[model samples]
Every structure is written in structure tokens, then in C-alpha cells.
Target: MASKIDPILEYDFCVAFLSNKWHTPPSNLKDFVVTSIQQTKSNATNMVSIISNFLKNKSFDPYVKDCLRTCFDLYSDSVSALDNAVVAFKNKDFDTASTKVSVSLDSPVACQGLFNDKKGENKSPLTKENRAYFQFSVIPFVFIQMCRIHN
Candidate 1:
């Protein structure tokens, strides 16, 4: 019979991966995880705020405005979901944290989907602005996967 993989080892690997991705040395494992999740949440919130402030002051075509507004709402939802995930994780409710993080991933996808037409051409102004969000979004998914591995 094959030996079962230890969850603590898996969790350590996950934390190391996140720390490397963030280009920061690992400190306390749980603290690192919680702080990294919080940073991702802050990023999502800040991006939404910036876009919303722009939309509020500028004049764009009605269609464009609607698209921007949709992106704003999606980003906001992502932030909220991430917040919930972090809270759940802190509470040691890994299942709830995983679910919330998984849900949060959809927001960015839906936000990006707004840029596509039936033919799937991507031309939304938000694309360039929001690109960084997509990059960082993967970390949360990784965190969720790590939790699964730990479980």
C-alpha cells in the first residue's frame, strides 16, 4: 500500500509557492496566508474603486458606460468573495473558504467576458487596466487548492 501524503507538507509547499510568487520570504505560515489573501482583496477593491471613480467623472458612450459599470460590479463582487474566503479561512473553515475563493474566480472571468462580442473580439478599455487583477487572481485559486491538498 502506498503511504498517504501528509497534509502539513502539502500546506507548507503551498505557502512556499505563494511566498515565492509574491517575491517575499515566508514568515509565519498562517500569517503569510492571511496577509496574502488580504492583499489580493485590497487589490480587487482598489481596482474597482479606480474604475468607478473614472466612470463617475467621465463621459463615455452609453454602451461603453454600461460595460464599464458591469466590470465595476464584478470586481466589487470578487473583492467581497475574497473577503469572505479570508474570514472563513481564518476561522479554520477550509471548505467555506475554498468555496468562496472559487466563487471569487468567476468575477474576473465574467468581467473579462464583457469585452468579448459573439465573434470573441476583446476590445474593452478595462482590459489593459484590469490585466494585473487577473494575474494576481490565480494566487487565491492556488490558495484554495492548497487548502484542498491540506484537507
Candidate 2:
């Protein structure tokens, strides 16, 4: 007999972000991939909303405001990429899905880079959010890799 597999174990990096119910017994690979992508898209959408709210805040300096605007654009691109990823997955195009997910993953890094000066003295207010989004974005990519391995 085959040994039992754990879906949660396959997504170790996502454990902190995943809910208690997501830790239950193993699910099929397709279900896991779908869930991972959908959850990531949802998280990215929330990030966009958070950044949008930050852009509306008038207390920040011009430099900070410019950084936030760039970050906002980056996150918007991420949301669009993830949306395309979802459609690719639905179309059973794993390669396209993987490519789209990879594209979505770069937003946080690019956003964070905008705040670093020559001396690296500047810090981003969205540090925590960017880190969280990066982690969240990794889930679907990992799941897609798993699917590739299984196939």
C-alpha cells in the first residue's frame, strides 16, 4: 500500500499564511494548485487595496509619495499577472501559469528597491506588507513546480 501524503507539507513555506482548515488531510494536486493560486490572487488584491489607501494619505513627503506611487503601480501589475495566471491554470496550460506566477512574484522586490538609497539608509513603510506579499506569492509557484514534478 502507498503511504499517505500531506498537502500542507508540500507547501511548507505557506504554513503561516494558510488557515487551519487548509492543514487538513491531503488533497489532489490539481485542487491544491487551484487553491494556492486563488489564495495568492486574493492576497495580492488586498495588497493593492492597502497601497491604494496609503496613496491617499497626504502626510507623507514628496519622495515617500513618489515611492508609494511606484509601489502602487507594481502591485497593480502583480494583480493583473495573477489574474492571467488563474486563467492559464484554468486552461490547463501549466507553463503559462508558471510564467505568470513568476511575473507576479517580482512586484514586491521592485517595490522595496525603490526605497533604498545609495547608502541604504532609507526604509520602506510597506516593508512588512511587501515581505508578506512576497511570501504569499511564492505559494502558487511552489505548487506549480510540484505539479510539474508529479507529471
Candidate 3:
């Protein structure tokens, strides 16, 4: 029930993340890996939709507009990377899957970085979304790493 049976994925955040998302607990590493990939893909897809909505808002200033546009691009790429990762996972290519997942993880950080002004006064409107995406992205990378190690 703790969702920490795998020593490689014993982190508290990972366990809690999986526990919240999974209705039936994962029985083994493959279950964990498959679920993690699916969930991360779903998260990325949702993020794309959210960013698209933000882009449609016409009241945002030019600076915020620029940041949102870039963030939208990053999240879009993240979705593609996660999609490729799903195929790689199905092929049992842990290396390719991990690489793609790792690429997906960078999107959140890159998106967050777009808000850092020179004076450090700007804040990302997507802060919460970026945080969730980063966490969702990490779970699959960790599971894929475990798969690589065991295989």
C-alpha cells in the first residue's frame, strides 16, 4: 500500500504521487513503469491544453505573452517527447524511453526559467502547473531508470 516496494523508487514524493494517481496499486516494476509513462503523457497533454488557453487570453502584457508563448512551445514539445517515450516503452527500449522522458522533464524547468527577469521580480503564472509537470515527469524517468538497471 505504501507503493515503495521498489528500492530504486523509494522516494517519498514518488510513492505519494503514484499512490494518488493509481486506483489499483502497481504490483511490480513493469506496472509502475507503464502507469508512470501513461500518467506523465496525460499530464503533458493536459499542460498543452492549459498553455493553449493561456495564450488565447488577450489581456496579458507583451512580456507575459512572450513567456507564455515560449512555455506553450516547451509543453508542446514535452507532449511529443512523452508520446515517443510511450512507444519506446512498449518496445522495451529503456534507453530510448529514459532519454525521451528526460527530455520531457526539461520542459517544465525551461518554462519556469522564462519568467526570471533580470531584476528577479517576475513570477511565472504557470508556477503550479510547471511544478506538477516536473513532478509527473520525474516519476517516469525514475521508473525507466529502474527498468534499465534491472534489465
* Best prediction by TM-score: 3
Please state the error at residue 76 of candidate 2 in Å: 1.1
Q: How many backbone clashes does candidate 1 have?
A: 0
Give me candidate 3's TM-score against the actual structure: 0.85
* Model 2 stretches astray by more than 4 angstroms: 1-13, 22-26
TM for every model, in the order presented, reads 0.72, 0.82, 0.85
Query: Against the unseen true structure, what C-alpha lDDT does each candidate score?
Result: 0.67, 0.76, 0.81
Residues 92-127, candidate 2, lDDT per residue (tens digit)? Answer: 888999999887688888888898866876668899
Question: Which residues of candidate 3, in runs, are more than 4 Å off?
Answer: 1-12, 21-25
Residue-level lDDT tens digits of model 1 in 1-151: 0012322224443455455655555465555557667777888888788778868856666666777788888888878888888888889887887677666566666777787766778757677556556555556556555655666
lDDT of 3: 0.81
lDDT of 1 at 126: 71
**Clash pairs (backbone) in predicted model 2:** none
Q: Between candidates 2 and 3, name the one with more favorable lDDT.
A: 3
Model 2 backbone overlap count: 0
**Order of models, best lDDT first:** 3, 2, 1
Candidate 2 weakest lDDT stretch, 10 residues: 1-10
